[model samples]
Target chain A: HNGSVFHPGTIVFPAALATAQAIGASGRDLLVAAVAGYEVGIRVGEFLGRSHYKIFHTTGTAGTLAAAAAVGHLLKLNPSQMLHAFGSAGTQSAGLWEFLRDAADSKQLHTAHAASTGLMSAYLAKSGFTGAEHILEGKQGLAAGMSSDSDPSKLIDRLGTRWTIAETSFKYHASCRHTHPAADALLQVMLKQDLKPSDIAKVETLVHQGAIDVLGPVTDPTTVHQSKFSMGTVLAIVAHYQFAGLQEFDQHFHDQDICSFRDRVTMVLDPEVDSAYPQSWIGKVKVYLNNGEVLEGRVDEPKGDPGNTLSRTEITDKAMRLAAFSGGASPSEMSAAIER
Target chain B: HNGSVFHPGTIVFPAALATAQAIGASGRDLLVAAVAGYEVGIRVGEFLGRSHYKIFHTTGTAGTLAAAAAVGHLLKLNPSQMLHAFGSAGTQSAGLWEFLRDAADSKQLHTAHAASTGLMSAYLAKSGFTGAEHILEGKQGLAAGMSSDSDPSKLIDRLGTRWTIAETSFKYHASCRHTHPAADALLQVMLKQDLKPSDIAKVETLVHQGAIDVLGPVTDPTTVHQSKFSMGTVLAIVAHYQFAGLQEFDQHFHDQDICSFRDRVTMVLDPEVDSAYPQSWIGKVKVYLNNGEVLEGRVDEPKGDPGNTLSRTEITDKAMRLAAFSGGASPSEMSAAIER
Candidate 1:
């Protein structure tokens, strides 16, 4: 997790589902494959370290190998074949952050490429197509080309003993993870003071450098997808609507009031937060009211984090809301599917 | 063309052909698109500089953009759309040298992925899928993330004035490009001396650091593909037979005599050659005979290089041989196609 923020589910789930369907695998097999993908991808992200996330997109790069691990597990590949799959997947590891500057559609493409390419790699390995043996830490491997701060130890730290999938957090706000900490902290202040959107004249978020590195580029977001990366936009949406859900982002991200509130927000780099970062994302914000009143808010664990994880009921509700927003399924069908 | 050795045709031609066939484009259209691809890919590889090629495979990383340029040109994309296509292609640029260490099949996969992905980027851009505006030189762009010695000026230098497509080389030997210079030098020595394999006791190849960096890992190549990267093996094949072509490598690469000759070959880094590399590949070799006599051989330009390019007749012969080797076409069919 380090300085890198990625949704392993975006890469792993697609690969697992695709492989499971292709192979007629059971639901239990899919779950096991998903776990394998999560374990490999999360550790690979950690292994790549902070420097890699600075330039390379971890979800695309490490995600490729993660996808291979999942698909390979589903295929019941031998250890040798699995290593070969990683090698091929690592060779194809790619995705840069430049697209964020233009609000490009590359983010979605990255996940698709990772999942498909990784799936292909596992299939190739099963057919005896050899690949590099040491693609992760080798002299000319992914870390050698993509990361300056790679730690080989992170790749196999606890192995079977540690289930890193549990460490994954759900997104409470339908926005960038970098904004969630600040979003939660702002919500805490609003609830405590019973403050309305018009009550707070200015909001200052004290965040780690990682937030700025990722969220700093979007000065004026033109699209809903891009606005999610804008710290100010997320905070403004949450302040006005109480939640930065898909509907809020879709309909009101560019609304006049939200845009005005967006301009009233700023991010300041804090040393304490930066130092504790990756390991822990601590949110601290300062609020200035029109009545010459100032209030500070802090949230050590943002909602949906492991420490403040969502309950089954909350997850179910969130799933239903997502289905409704996307018009993916009717309520009865969604409930039936969820129950199954 | 600098320190990076790539077969631009491997990426560009495939993409151009695929796009042209899909769209029913003219042969002239395919030719122009290929030229565009070659120009963009070569410049990108040169701009990335030697540092990028050290770890990243130039053909895979730069080739993706090249493929995109070719396909984009074939699609008749406007400047903005072409730029967007490049942005998407660059974000997905990837391939590592670690695969070479294991004689992996990733090299073929790299070209396939680049060609397909690049083609897809062009189609996406045509559909108004926006990409980064300045993907190559942007803060989190391809160069920023993949290369430390990237030169921004080289990307646009000479623009329409210089036709880089003319600079591309044909591979005279079936082995890696790094081995070609020395292979030619060895051929020169053997021909001039009119000596057989038994006449040579030991041979030392004077090469650039790039050659050593690429060929140093294949100490005892077990596969025919791996043997191509082995400096010792390539030299051995060339010494025993006048040429190291596909047939020779396939059938005789693992022969005991060839393996013994492989052990007798050694590579020594030469300062003059190292400094002049990328721009010029000078071959210098020392051949020690069993009769206690030594001879020096030098070749300023390797066979198949722009300066010493193959003639049309030789090219046709080579194509026919290739078709025969792969059983892809009959001699008459090849000639008919070549005539067209």
Candidate 2:
């Protein structure tokens, strides 16, 4: 595990699963490819920098390489073929932050496209198609177009030594990762006080400044998916529903409780928390109670962080519940697949 | 057709053909989509600018949008659905100039991915998936990530009044468009002087400055496809074989005679040619004979230029030859498919 904060799961998870199914690859190959996805993808994410993040999503950019690397590994591509695969991947690399301003379901499509494209790139290379060898550092390369500032060393340093998948932390809340720390901090407040949503007059959350571009201004999401990015909606869901999970997201737009509570919940940038970012994405929650009592809580990191991991039981419970929810079948019909 | 210089065939041709096959759209719809591809793609390409071309192939970038527009039109998509299609297409838009450096078969791949992605985007929109509405103009939109300078008005101005596809011209030379003018100019030189490759000591060519970027400095290509971008190889193939056609490209890399004359040719910038660039892509060729005789020729526009259209018979001959070269089945097997 290394010290990168990018999320490789969106890129690697869908990519590996799809490619594994397509090729009938072994579990070992799948794991190896998934790991390669994280290592290769997250480092590329770092090179793209915060400036690139202002417009492009790393999952679409770096994710293409991750998917290609994983699929290429499974295909047993030689280095030259892999370079060609990367060349095609780089040429097709794209994902924009513009979707954040729209209520479109493009978020899911991003992962789908990245995964399929990764497989496609690998297949293209296997068919004897050559590609740009120095795709990363070429004059008209990903780095040149996407980012003015990037560290090539970060992309290649400890290529075989560090396993970045080890550093990847899972999400406990189903909302956007940026909204998690605030929701997590508020979860503690709700638990410790045992206060109902009505008992809270107003709620304020403190999050790092870097989240402004991502989770800003889209507070009144018309669609369920959009609610995930709305810090207000995420906090309101946590306050009223007690858990921010798949059901909560599905109900975000229609639920009157979440809607009403959303207005009372607000976020402000905290200098202290902003300084700690992105090394440590911290959140501070302040609650004004109707009973004239104020409650404050802080969390350096959200649940399931590398430093604060979910228990094996918790993860297993989530996986089982998610499998049941997303995968429609009787328990008898699904148990074997779920267990595997 | 409009005055925009972007190539629409790579984007619209595949996209319309595939979508037409998929949906059984009317011939009218297919033609409408192709026209939409040229108009929409060229405008988007304008916004992307030449700087973007340094990194991305416009066929893959603006081309994706063109494909989507064409597919979306055939699908009878409402304005909202079309917006979503564009949104999804923008997210996946990519193609790198890096491939040109590697001489990879990525050129074909760019067109393939653009076509497939366009079909995929439209299909997703039809299925009710959301995409960015302001994918081109949004804060973190395609223009932001791909280009530093853009003219958004060009993307929408006189959309119906000016048809960009009308300006589209065919290529007589089988090489890249940059090499076409030179190849055309050389054809005249060979015909006028009845010269052989052995009779030539050194030859010089004058082409637009922009052509320098496309056909520059790739003198020793190991593949036939790469030879398309090498101005020397294109010229030599014309000089020796007396014609630059698909069959010639298929044989360029392996020919010893073409390789021998490749070294004898060079390119230099001509201010007169540079000034007439987008308005007219002209080439001037000067052949110095070993016998101390000099032959010169100039072509203001290559064969198949809008002002110099290839004869319908010539087009049909090329098409028939190409069909026979690539199609492996019997005439009856093709008849059933060709009838459709």
Candidate 3:
């Protein structure tokens, strides 16, 4: 499977669900459409990675490709029509990292925008509206404008044979996926040693230089975004709270002991780990205890990776809990209906 | 007024008409909205002009800016809402120049896409969905990714007082605006001489280098686009037919005597004219007649330029002709109703 920096699910679900509803498709059809959506999106994202990520959101920029491919497939578009879809979708592609500066909900908006634009592109192409034939590799095109260094072969090489969705990672953590490895590593050390927050002298998390650039400042987080991105705050929350729950991002946790202990945490750049990233998001953590004892944990790949997927029971339980929290019926009744 | 490579009317009219119809706005409201739309769109287009034009159609790229501004004005959007409208619209901006190669209907499609996207942006912003605050001028933004040479200060400078629509040109010729000056010069020469096509020996058109670059190859055109962009074909049609009407672009005229005579025409580059262009679309035509007479004609500005605005009677008469040609009733009755 091709590697992408952004989660394909955030892009695929919005497009698939919207298209499914529009076409009166079944759940199975939605799944198949989602698969195509994920594959196309992931490949385009992987192709436009690095330089594109420096300025734009992979979810919005490359996600349009996924959406168009998936919806176009569902509509049984001819190759010419498909090309037009890509043309229109490529021209429309846009999303920016600037939103992250304001912690704006524009992140969600980006996904929605991609979904709708993809739908529009497909519909127009189907109606015989022409788009650029060489939107990706053309001299003056998306990659040329959006990427400083780009390899378009990544977009088509082994396209049909390689199924990116099958290799996608699932997430159990509430914070950003980037923080999951460190959180997993830290939790394991504390769990194995049976040590409380008071037993720790200081905590250090080591990962790739790329990770440090993304998750930085190893300091207290004043906002939810800061908590999600800052390794120090994420690690502090995991170690001190003994769990990395959604509530950990709340502002009420600001005055907690974890926020102060977050200052003691340091993030280091390990070249070994640095060489592994964007392909492998690995993390290693070391803890010094007040009792003059040390514990260490390392994770090459965090839980929920394709190699270490969550069990069916765990997934069902998580689903039920989420449904109940979102004002659904009792978990047992909901499960029964779903099963039926 | 800021200059835009794409006609702002295509973008402005679609968004304004749709939004006005929905909101029950009067003609005055639509006009005001259109003015705002034209100004904002023109500024953004000028900023992203060269590099963006290489790949993207200016209509689809900058048209969104115009649509959003115009519709957002009619919707009474505040500054922050307007910002979000721009944010979402810019990300959704896309249209490729590849359509030009095919002479496809996608050129018109780009305008429609901008109209809908602009409306959607305004609607989403009004609903409190957040978008990037500095979408245009941000470090990682539309200008950065879309243009190799971009200056975003133009987006806000003299935004209100400098009216782009006021300076807008209203094209009367059937062909592309680039061909207008040459057509005007040719028609003037023909009218002065009262000459038949057989009377002409050879023809030479001297225009700015910029115009030559856009309208190339002094040769016969097989397609309407070629006729529109070719200096020779346009000159032949204007001189022989004595009019550059819409019907002259039809394929029936491809085998006409003018097509063969088009070979007698040549285009020249004038450095003085080149330096004056985009601001001035001037062309000089010199014709050598078989009757041993050389007639010279020049036009400093085409018929539709703001400096040589068409009179109200001329505008109304042209509108009535178009309306009647498109299945409207008698001009007198239609004009009376329109005036009311």
C-alpha RMSD values across all candidates: 1.4, 3.7, 4.5
lDDT of 1 at A145: 92
Best by TM-score: 1
TM-score of each: 0.98, 0.88, 0.83
Residue lDDT tens for model 2, A1-340: 1134456777777777877898899998899888877788888877766677767777777778888988888888999898888888877788887898877777777777777787788888998877888778777788888888667887887778876677778788887888888888888898987988889888888877657778774867987778888888888888877788987788564588778888888878899987776657787999889998889988886888888989877886677767677876655655676576
**10 residues in a row with least lDDT, candidate 2 chain B:** B1-10
Tens-digit lDDT string for candidate 2 (B1-340): 1134467887798889988998888888889888877777888887776667656777788878888999999888899999899998888888877777767777887888888888889888999988998899888889888887677887877878867776678877777887777788888888877777888898888877657766673767877778888888888888878778878878664588787788888889989987776667887988889999888888987888888888877776666666777786555555565556
Q: Model 2 chain A — which ten-residue stretch has the worst lDDT?
A: A1-10
i-RMS for every candidate (Å) is 0.8, 1.0, 2.1
DockQ of each: 0.87, 0.72, 0.44
Residue pairs with colliding backbones in model 3 are A91-B94, A92-B94
Worst 10 residues of 1 chain A by lDDT: A1-10
Kindly report which residue pairs in candidate 2 clash with one another: A91-B95, A91-B96, A105-B130, B1-B163, B1-B166, B1-B167, B2-B163, B2-B164
- lDDT, residue A149, model 3: 69
Candidate ordering by lDDT (highest first): 1, 2, 3
Q: Give lDDT tens digits, candidate 3, residues A1-340.
A: 2167776777677777777788898888788878888877887888886778777778888888888888887787899999888877876776776665555566777787788788788888898876767777665567766777677787887878877777877676667677778788888898987878778888778876546544553244556755776666777778777666666556434656767777777888878776777778786888888888778888888877887788888677677766776677797887996688
Identify the runs in model 1 with alpha carbons over 4 angstroms from their true place.
A1-4, B1-4
A1-340 per-residue lDDT for model 1 (tens digits): 4334667999999999989998999999999999999999999999998888888789999999999999999999999999999999999999998888889888998999999999999999999988899999999999999999999898888888978888889888999898999999999999999999899999999999878888899989999999999999999999998899999999999999999999999999999988888879999999999999999999998898989998999899999999998899989999999999
